[model samples]
Target: MIFGNPGITYAATVEVEAESAILVDAETGKILFEKEADLTLPPASMTKMMTEYLVLEAIEEGEISWDTTTQISDYPYSISADPSFSGVGLTQNQDYTVRELYEAMAINSDNATTIALAELIAGSEGAFVKMMNKKAAELGLPDYQFVNSTGLSNSNLGENYPEGTEPNANNLLSARSAALLAYHLVNDYPEALEITSITTTEFDGQQIRNWNWMLPNMPGYLADYGYEGMDGLKTGWTDLAGYCFTGTAERDGQRFISVVMKTNSEEARFQETRKLLDYGFKQFEQKELFPAGYQIEGESEVPVAKGKEGTVEIEAAEDLTTPVKNGQEDMYEVKYNISKEHLDKDGNLTAPIKKGEKIGTVELVYNGEDNYKNLVTGKTQKTAVDLVTTSAVEKSNWFMLMVGGVGNFFSDIFTSAMDMVKGWF
Candidate 1:
């Protein structure tokens, strides 16, 4: 049976200053707010989050180790020598450990170090770009295109653009896509935060600071933008991409991931992100709309055919809990879907149903105006719980089954005869 609640208030809305922006619950990937979130734009340095994910995955899979070292190729060496790009100077054919390069890339947004790590892992940057695109598809990112490891336009790489890519190409992602990438990075390899959270770390005896000023421990002038509960995330900018950031923070057992793209200035990215995160933390609360074993009133039972009992009761197999907007409890409703495979032709469950037997599922649907899609799957966020039988229903004995069959046969015959007589009249 279908049931619904009445009266839904519009979800509160907040304005953010950016071309594209999104906020999501880090744990559930449920989008809390979005504006032009699907508009594809250059991600700049935020592209490295994908690189970071692949590196951590390689390490976890035993393909490489933190101590693994690779020599600097001439391509990366030339890029490192240019001060215009973010990099640490590298000597030709000199060795550097994965740990060192990874820290520089994550903390300082070092383009050359990022490319070097990509080459080390995939034997070449071109191969690494392939891995990035493949992994994005695997992760269900809605919109993305990876042309280089550093998020730089291939024009910046000059003659060294990765093979099979356009020289004018730059990495692109929608805000939703960027948030999804960050979601997987943090959840899959949380250890990455250890390096990204560092405000400043010495690399080759030179101090390099993280680009994300929202981190809690910024020193000097950057301290002005510090935000509590903020941690390691990537920041980005280019002539084409404007300023962008993928930021994540945790407080009071809640974590939010935010992305702001094409903001006007270096500080605007963080400021816009602050708006997104604040809206999430201040306006929503963890709510259990329904508890486990919950059953809808007047619609909790399913008929059982040829069983000792006439019907079987069903209830939710697990709890339905998620972040809900404050004072918007009535905006949500539950829907039950019975499994056709478990029901007979007459819509009755077969005999001998076991207790807690898998039968159907109940899903939560949002009726408010600000309903949003999942960050990863790009589908409407409908959380579902399994429905199972509350108790077993034993099959009737042979005598009872025969009696029921006889009753059904006589009833059908009587109905047909009545219809025939009416037709003759």
Candidate 2:
């Protein structure tokens, strides 16, 4: 597919801790914008989000409970605080509720809490890491790895895992992977936002400030564009991962995800995240081109040989929506082709069709101008339709039967028999 779109680039702000970025709409999975979203980079504390995911999964499945408590072990990192402003004064025997640990893990970015939870969940951080990798595979995030639950820089601990001959980074992730992890966490678990969005909270009656300064302190990220429905996410930083933040916002039932990684400084990460989010919020508007369960245009209706009703309805499997910069709304042109080989001799649609099953495709031809066409693919979207056979029993009124097969039950019985004897023929 050829996309005749205007050219656009984010190279202007290309510098510092940011190695790559990607902007996508959560509601639509539409890639409104992106820049090297797939490039893998050190994730730092951002890896905790995946840990959050596993923990939540465990809790929801009754493997653990909110009230369930675990003992904090004396891991090297969990025990030693730089005497800096850190949460978790974790001692060897101290116990914490699963909910409390989750808060510590997400709200305060407590690496120690993460390691503890990971260790308890799988009996050891190493075994838990296997869980993390398994979960990543389940979620389809390929460019991520968790050697340890705590996302400490890899350069410090040399490779101790397999024979890769590389350093043993406690955890590593990409901008896209981070966003995906946070996306599922935020949307799937409302409790996560209830924790991460809080500026401050008490655990054992001590106030622990959220590491993600954007929540209450950073003015750079406090955009009044009505926040575009901004929601709570996490922030990350390290000598390796640099300054990174994953942000999400929703508006009018639409959600957008933006990932800014490797920013030079803490402030720079927020600034770049704001810039990327602004570009996304400004450049694209998601509009539905079609609706689900709606009849497919230019399709055939099934003919009934010995049934009460004559025909049934068929439609596209799912709704279709496209994201495009403003004024480019009308730029998408749909080109359709009919496949007679897949249809019966008559113009009526045949049965055995599933929802989202493909009857045909719609090729979106983009109006190439500016840089729009150059950046994204031209084919706008694909369309699926179901093939269902409908008929009515005995109808006294011919016109009414034409409308709904006698508008009665005799045909319904026939349909039941049809299903039963479907394989008979």
Candidate 3:
């Protein structure tokens, strides 16, 4: 049933009511879908995923520990006490473990706790934001910017503003870039999901609820909207940002990361995300295009002009497996393009060929246009591999070359006589 020319027929027309949205395969970094995904927009609480990532990185670096405790500063304490802000309420001067703070920040989307974790890692919220930006650069996220550990727009802080804080300050990320962030978070810190996935937990004996309702255990939404295998990431909302969620899910061994930003309501963000995820899961599949060391049965050998054996066998250096939609695996044709550098004007290799030299590329292409009606974009489904010599090929010695020439002359005559005999028969 494998076919090409991917169509959206199997996909339900999902109208995503969001400023930007993107779905990505976390493992392979393949973008499944996107809408206005490059537009810069408020990240909202989804910014906490980066904060959590940095915290986990620090923990892995042995710079911090789950059991390590830090005293609550006035900023975090005041933010926690402010009814307008989301927080795990903390008394001033109270010490809390890194683990508890992480729970508050990730599960509950507590601004104060997020700030605390940021400060603990970077000595100041601003410094931690710098680190966030640095990490974003390292991850190849070109358009992401973080102003604070929490995604709160500065306008929401009211009269309790910090001295040097700017109004309307907030983190920003494109939907595609946000998906990349989530990709790194899950791939690098599988343990962080344990904390982010918690729908309810007690901190200081108070039951805190996670804001991400898409989780299967999120109580009221479980039977309806709760997606199985939906674990973590973060959710966010502000008057300007509306409702945003960066969600990750795993099913049947495949993991997907989805980002929905600036939806009209909390429900729409999750619901639309579910549709996108469904389309991605149904329409695409992972398939191997080529296996390592695979040699074409009848076409394995390339003529070598000066080699001892007069020819050499080649193979692909490695395997290539990518997510292909519309059963492209069967319909897509494999083309091996041998490089001119490996051949002379007569179309035969002039050897002294090294064992592992690059000599060709393999490409996968469909016959017709893709879903977008584009020509399926050449080089999108291609990989250049070293066409290694299975055995080293050296130039023939003078006597060997003379003998080979004589042998080839007789061999050609004998082949002609056999062909004539076959023709008569």
- Ranking according to TM-score, highest score first: 1, 3, 2
lDDT of 1 by residue, 1-425 (tens): 22344454554678999999999999888999989999999999999999999999999999999999988888998899998984778777667899999999999999989999999999899999999999999999989999999999999999999997999998999998999999999999999998999999998789988889999869988999998899969999999999999999999888899999999999899999888888999898778888999898888999999899999999999988788887677777787899999999999999899999989898887776665677766778879999999999999999999999999999999999999999999
What number of clashing residue pairs does each candidate have, in the order they appear? Answer: 0, 27, 0
Q: Candidates' TM-scores?
A: 0.93, 0.72, 0.81
| Candidate 3: 10-residue stretch with minimal lDDT | 371-380
Ranking by lDDT: 1, 3, 2
Which number leads on TM-score? 1
Off by over 4 Å in 3: 1-13, 157-165, 221-223, 292-299, 337-361, 366-368, 371-425
Could you tell me which residue pairs clash in candidate 1?
Answer: none
The local distance difference test score of model 1 is: 0.90
Q: Provide the overall lDDT of each model, using Cα atoms, as 2-decimal numbers.
A: 0.90, 0.63, 0.78
Worst 10 residues of 1 by lDDT: 1-10
Which regions of candidate 2 are displaced past 4 Å? Answer: 1-17, 76-85, 154-167, 216-228, 291-319, 333-425
